[model samples]
Target: MIVPVILSGGSGSRLWPVSREHYPKQFLNLHKDDASLLQEAARRLDSLDNVAAPTVVCNETHRFMVAEQLHQVGVEHARIILEPCGRNTAPALALAALAACQASASARLLVMPADHVIKDEAAFARAVMQGQALVERGRLVTFGITPYTAHTGYGYIKRGEALGEDGFNVDAFVEKPDAERARAYLENGDYLWNSGIFLLDAKGYLEALAEYAPDILEACDSAYKAREEDADFVRVDDERFARCRSESIDYAVMEHTRSAAVVPVDPGWSDIGAWDALYELKAADDTTSGNALHGDVMLHATRNSLIHSESRLVAAVGVEDLVIVETDDAVLVADRRCAQGTKHIVNELKASGRRECQSHQQVYRPWGHYRTMVLTDSFQVKEIVVKPGAQLSLQMHHHRAEHWVVVEGTAEVTQGEGHGNTGDMKSFLLSEDQSTYIPLGTVHRLKNPGVIPLRLIEVQTGTYLGEDDIVRYSDDYGRG
Candidate 1:
């Protein structure tokens, strides 16, 4: 059976405001009404024959999001490998290949990125089937998108000799070119956009990696062997994986392997690398010529623009080729032509030590999520939701006191002295409209033992209200 390996380890900076370092594009339902790119990626191969559950490789920080999105797609029996740090694609693929081989000796890995969109699902499946045929003959197959435009955003693949009905031996791999060179590539029909999608025999890939990129393969092997299975993630040894060299498969294996092959496909695929890409995607489906609007947005005399509003009404007037994205804490307005360069904004934000670059006003935890509603010098207000049967850690703060108002469902409250020297340990249930207080230095835990999500308003008064103030005595999600 073919095992799908989805790589979801990118800090999508170019699509910022909507895509942050902590919550990137892969997990977002960007079009608003559809499944996220990750969910769609997880379900893309459901129509294929002999397909097993997928294995996802993502950053440790994104484990919960990956699991939650997969669960939303009904992919219950899948592996989620957490990389301690970003080690790039080659190491990620190596770890995935090792895991696949362990599960089934003869497993074939159909590898792809989680943040890609393939509009033509049937066509993509057909390409996968074609790739499987090529892999059967000892070839490492990569998908080369048939280029219709002079797009400098993607690398180019040159097709050489034909191997099968639809597959070809890879002649050369070219980096992203200048506009003139891209136009030349488009005019000449021999080049294709490298899609970074691949199909290879798991054992064969390991052997090739051993031959070509020994350091990466060896490091990944050690890390995989030392891996411990956590509650919902495969935890690798941080130090071991950190020693692995960061490289892409194109550089580490496929580009150097003699058995490299390409299957040309045109399935309306996009990496969604920028806001303009999203604009174009929505524009294709929109009957209007000038605007691609999302959320509660109104556009007037807007020509070739994208306006996205998340929380409030956004009005755009007399704009042309502009991109306006509004979030709770930040707003980005950039020229559509320069949307791809928006990564510079993220770079600047990072240089300035801005929190908006890393996360949104809302933060997600294993239990559920919380949004910062208001903040002052000595107090803050938050809206929190805990999933059914989920609970917070038995924790305490030295500088903060909390007031919680139960808004929905029931909250199971545990308050007491901390660190097992039990004193004033009490437990109670609070339904809607009920309230409670947690004094400073008081050990406490909030749980949702009910069937529905527990929503509450948390108002805090403290000299310091940072998240790092927590001293966790016991945590269900294994955080230290």
Candidate 2:
């Protein structure tokens, strides 16, 4: 059986504003109307035969998002492994291989990054079939995209010798080349863009890692051995895994392995590395003016540009070759030619300690989500939504007092003084237009007891209204 291992650890800084550190591009519905990029990755495997439910490797902060998205896409029995920190592709693959090998040592892994776009599912499945044959022969297999352009943004792989009708032994892995060299590579007809997709034997990968990157293999092994299952997630030991050095599979194993092999295929693939790449993917569907407009956007004399508006109308006049992205809290305007420089702006925002670089106004949680509507020195207001049967933690805030006004559905509220006893605790129902107040240091909990989502407005009066002010007694989501 083939175990699909989906790696989703990218921050997607280049797709900033819409794709923040907390909610990255993989979780956004960039291409498909119904599925996000990660969902597309999971669903694409449905075309293949004998593939198991995917083992998703993601950051600890994105565990809930990963699980929820996969569930929405009807992918059941998936193993969602949470990495305490980012250790790049090598360690991520190690964790996946270790977990997969638990069930069968000879399991073949179809490694795919969660954030990629592959438009041709038939071609992808065919390539995987070819890769499966090569992998079964104890060869480490990586897919190489048939280069259509002299694009310097991606690494290149030179084919050494033909292994079979559809495979080649990798001669060398070339770094991103300069313009002149990239043009030469496009003309050479023997190079392929390194696609970062791979098919590998689980035991064979572990053996290769042990030979070339024993430190990484050992660290991942220790962490996997000490892993604990929390709900639908596998939590590896943070300290042990953090000690694993950051490296890509190319550098740590495939670069040095004698069994390295490459399968050349074209599946209309793109990493969506920057806005210009997104424009390129979307440009064909637009008018002859080469404008890709999304949401409420109007353009006059705008040529070869991509404009996206999330909350309000965005209008552009006489602009050419530009990218304009408008979110609730931020807007990014850049020349299309310099779109890759967007990451530098994210870095500057991080260096300046800006929260805009981290999340949007609406933040997601396992229960539901909340959006800050208003804020001031002494007071703040938020719109909170709770999913049916979902509840928040039984907690209290030392620095804030809250008032909740129900807007829709029904709420089962538990509020009291001290530690919520039968006498002190009051269990009550709050319907539409109903309100309640929880004084400072009052341990309280809110739940959606109805069949529909519960929506409410929360008013906070406090000296400090940060999220870290809460002291939780218990949480259903296993959050501390």
Candidate 3:
């Protein structure tokens, strides 16, 4: 059996505004309307045979989103490993390998990132099959993309002696190069872009890790041994996993392993590292004006540019080789050539302690999502939606009182005092146009007890209206 391990722990700061700390690029439907990049990655395996359910490794905070998205795509039996802190791909892959070997001793693991775009699924499958064939011989296979341009965005892989028709011994792994070096590598025709996708025998990978990076192997082993299962999530020991030094697969294992092999392929792949990649991707599909526009956008003489508007109309008069993205809360404008520099802007926002750097006006929870409609020093207003059969935690605020007005469906409201005692609670149903008030320090829970979604307007008044003001006495989702 082949186990697909999807690594999805990137912050994707370069694609901010749309991609935040809480909702990253993997969970976004950038190329497709209904399927996200992660979904596309998971669905890609549907073409291959003998593949088991995927094991997803993501940040702990993103566990709900990952599960929800996978469920949306009819993937229910996935094992989601939650990392308290990212220790990079080496440790992430180690966890997956350990889990895979535990399930089936002969299982091979196909590891891929969640946020990559591969247009040619057939070619990708062919490459993966080639790697799988090589894996049978105990080869640590890395898929190398056949480079067509002098792309400085990706590292280069030098091919050594040919293993077969489509496989080669990995001669060297080169870091991201200058434009000159990149061009040389492209012209030389002996180099391929390091695609970061790998196929390995589960037990063989663990042995390689033990030989090449024993400390990482040991740390991950201890963490995996101490793992606990919560619903669909497998959570490792936080402290032990955090002790594993952060390192990429290239640095910790592949670079040191003599069994490294490469399978060069051209699968129309993109990491979608920055806004420019999106432009390039869309521009490929439409070549009339070299402009890739999304949402409510009107462009005039905007050649070779990308303009995306999420909530409102964006008009560009005269822009060339530019990228403009407008969301509900923020807008990004940059030269397409310098789109990679957007990470520095994210760093600046972080240094300034800006909330926009972490999240948007809308926040997602296990129950549903809430969008801040208005915010101020003394009060705030939000529009919240609860999925059918979903409920919020039995929670209370230390410094704030809340007023909720039901706008759609029905709401089951529970309000109480004194140590969150349900026996002392007053529970009632509020239909459309009805309202309820929750005073400060009152234990309250909201549930959508109808067949449809429940929509409500929430007004909060307080001296401190920060999200941390809430104390969750009991939670349906295992939140602290």
Candidate 4:
């Protein structure tokens, strides 16, 4: 049997604004579909015969988002492993391999990143079948992409003698080459772009890791053994995990293993690392113009440009090879060639302490989302949408008090003390235009009691209105 392991821990700083530290491009509906890249990656593996439910490894901050997205696609029984701190792909895969081995002794693990786009699922599955046969024989396999262009953004793999009818032994792994060297590699026709996907049996991988990176293997083993299961998440021991050095699997194992092999796959694959790559994947018009994402847009004589708008209409005239992205808090306009440099801009923003570099004005919560509409010294206003039957945490703030006015549907407000409240509580029903005040230190909670989405205008007033001021008394979402 094969078990899919998804690594979803990238910050994707290169695709900033839409991709933030709090929410990255992997979770974004970049294809303008309901399913995110992570969802698509997991769902595509469902058709494979004898494939078990995927095990996801991600940063602690993304655990809830990953779980919620998988649940939306009707994917249950997925094991979510949380990393206390990222130790790169080597430790990430080690943790996943350990988990898979515990679940099934002889499981073949297919490791994939959550942020990649594979346009041809059929071709990908066929390649996986070929790799699986080799993996079962204890060969460490890596999928290499047939280069469609002499691109310098990715590393290349040189193929050695053909191992069989399916694949070839890896000759060498090359770093990103210059344009001239990349052209020569394309001309030679034996080099393939390193796709970073790997397939290997759990036990075989552990053995190879122990040989090549014994420190990483030992750290992962200790962390996994000391892990604690909380709800649906497996929290790794931070102290042990922190001792694990950060390194990629390519450098830590694949490059050093004698059993490394490369399987060529021709699927239309892109890391989607930058806006220009996203532009290339879009369906262009006769003039090579495409709008990749949602929001109102108008273009005239715009060719080879990618524009995304989140809140307002963007009109472009005679713009060529440009990227225009608009969000509620920030806007990014750059030449297509400079798309990779957006990471530098994100760094500058971080150094300057800009919030736009970290998250959008609207933030997602377990229950739903809340957007700040206005803010001032004494008061703050927010527009909140609560999913049907969802509830916020039962908490209180020492620095601020909030007034909630229901705009649509009904809300069941637990005021002071009630049956649902752990301590002294009062209950009240609020309808459209009805308002209630949650005084400072007064434990309260908001619940959507209606069938439709519950919208409310929350006005907070106090000396401080930061998000961390809340002291959670009880939470249905298991957040403390």
Q: Global lDDT for candidate 2?
A: 0.94
Assess the local accuracy of residue 86 in candidate 2 as a C-alpha lDDT between 0 and 100. 98
The candidate maximizing lDDT is 2
Flag the better candidate by TM-score, 1 or 2: 2
Where does model 3 exceed 4 Å of error?
417-423
Task: For model 1, name the residue pairs that clash.
Answer: none
Worst 10 residues of 3 by lDDT: 417-426
Put down candidate 3 lDDT per residue, 30-125, tens digits, no spaces: 988889999999999988888999999999999999999999999979999999999999999999999998999998999999999999999998
Q: Please, what are the lDDT tens digits per residue for candidate 4 over residues 215-243?
A: 99999999999999987799999999999
Question: Candidate 3: how large is its RMSD?
Answer: 1.1
C-alpha RMSD for every candidate: 1.4, 1.2, 1.1, 2.1
**Candidate achieving higher lDDT, 2 or 4:** 2
- Score candidate 1 by TM-score against the native: 0.97
Task: List the candidate 1 regions with Cα displacement exceeding 4 Å.
Answer: 418-424
Candidate order by TM-score, decreasing, is 3, 2, 1, 4
> Candidate 3, 423: how far from true, in Å?
4.2
